[model samples]
Target: MRTVYSEDHRLHDGKHELLEGQFMKVHESPSRADIVIGRVRSAGLGEIIAPQEFGLEPILKVHDEGLVRFLENAWDDWAATGRTFDALPHVWPVPGLSRGALGRRLSDCIDGKLGYYAIDAGTPIMSGTWAAVRASANVALTAQKLVATGEKSAFALCRPPGHHAGSDFYGGYCFLNNAGIAAQAFRDQGARRIAILDVDYHHGNGTQQMFYERGDVLTISLHADPEQEFPYFIGYADEIGAGAGEGYHMNLPLPWGTDWQGYSAALDRAMKRIEQYGAEALIVSLGLDTFEHDPISRFKLAEADYQRLGQRIAWADLPTLFVMEGGYAVEALGVNTVNVLMGFEQR
Candidate 1:
């Protein structure tokens, strides 16, 4: 598997993120990508290629235009206010707040816009956010193109991981949905049926929302149950796609402390669903955060277990593109992540 990466990912490096009622160092650090890439090289996991310059055109297909424009200008807009130390939203327009009635356009206040577009306060915007985010999307798109052109499998080592961001909302340290964008690009390129298997520790709410109303792309995610997880909203097994997408969407929520035995059972079920769907291609929202020591994650799959995870994925035997997502155990991130890719190859 050829791994696609970008040094430009360092651009979106943040200082701190608001979590657990205090601002602490961001877990989604540049070193996370560095460690993973270094492991890829150390393990000789194929050549590492730079991503092609796919501009916002492909991204716009999976995101809202105004949201895109907002992300583009968010940093500078916040900086203009002269209180910049890593911009985080302080307020949100949720539910019955009359302040939310400032109209659907969102008030001109930059703070309000930040909250309006953001799903949580944990994803802070830095100076290089937009540039880095665009680059990350390009990386995913490039990998998808390679798989479509007949590469057996490709890994998009995207940073500031996506999957948390919906069409107009960004959070969970995700600025854009890389897996979502790639799946849509696959459809645009005439892939009749493609399935996204998001094995991240967190639910791919954004990816689910993007395809929840469509049947062309089947989206499935196995993650920490929403009731007890960070997103704390969707991801229930009951959210089986809507309308034309009915039964096309699936969510297998696992409890905290789930080990390999528990995880594999869910993986088996997910693979079976994809097989039944008869997908031509697969987009694995690869996240190694479910590791036993992941800082903010709860699953307990150990290091060697990742290889088994990948081997199982290889069983599906479909053209696959692995788009990097969450996994905050920076030290072990590489070993676990590359293990999955290598496992798939060895199979």
Candidate 2:
């Protein structure tokens, strides 16, 4: 598989994020991509190409204009107040406050806008965030282009992982929803039916929300159950889509402490759904945080199991695009991530 990468990912490095009622060093750092790229080279996994600039047009296809504009200017806006630290939201526009007139006025203040556009406090915005996220989206789009144009498979090594971001809100260390953008790119490029299989330890709430009302792109996620995971909302078994998209979306939420046996069973069911969907192409939101040693996530998947995961994905027999999502066990990220690609290639 050819891998699409970008040096710009290093630009978005953040100092700290609010987690568990305390500020801590960000887990979604540049090293995650650094190690994965190193392994791809060491394993000789075909070509490693820089991403082509797809620009904001493709991103706007899935994300809100206000959210994109906020990300693009957030650091500068925050810095204008003389705060040099990374920008993190201190407050959120909860349900009632968000729907009332207060939400409209909040958009004018940088502090208020931070909460207005963000879903959680974990994602910090620094000066280089916009550039990094833009490059990340380009990486995903480049890989999607490869698969849409006839490459058997490609890897979009995106950073500031995007599964948790929705069309109008950003969180879970994600800014632009790369997988959602890529799936839309596939549609724009003429694939009639597309399937996105998210194997992240956390649910892909953003990707699901983007396609939940559309029938063309089938979104399936196998992740830690929402009741027990981060982004503790949505991603239930019953959120099977709405309106024209009813029955088009599927969420197989697994419990905490799930290991290879349980994960593999969910993968089998997801694969079966893709077969039934008759999808013209497939996009895998490849997140290795399910690994046994990952800090923030709670699954127990071992390194070897990733290969089996990849092999199962291969059995789907569609042109595939793997978009990197989350994996914080930086030391072992390379092995677990490459194991999946290696398995897919071998299969």
Total clashing pairs for each candidate: 0, 0
Q: For model 1, how many clashes?
A: 0
Using lDDT, give the best candidate's number.
Answer: 1
Residue 273, candidate 2: Cα error in Å is 0.3
Model 1 lDDT per residue over 142-176, tens place: 99999999999999999879999899889999999
Candidate 1 colliding pairs: none
TM-score to true structure, per model? 0.98, 0.98
RMSD to native, candidate 2: 1.3
Q: Model 2 Cα displacement at 200 (Å)?
A: 0.3
Candidate 2: stretches off by over 4 Å:
98-105
Error of 2 at 322 (Å): 0.3
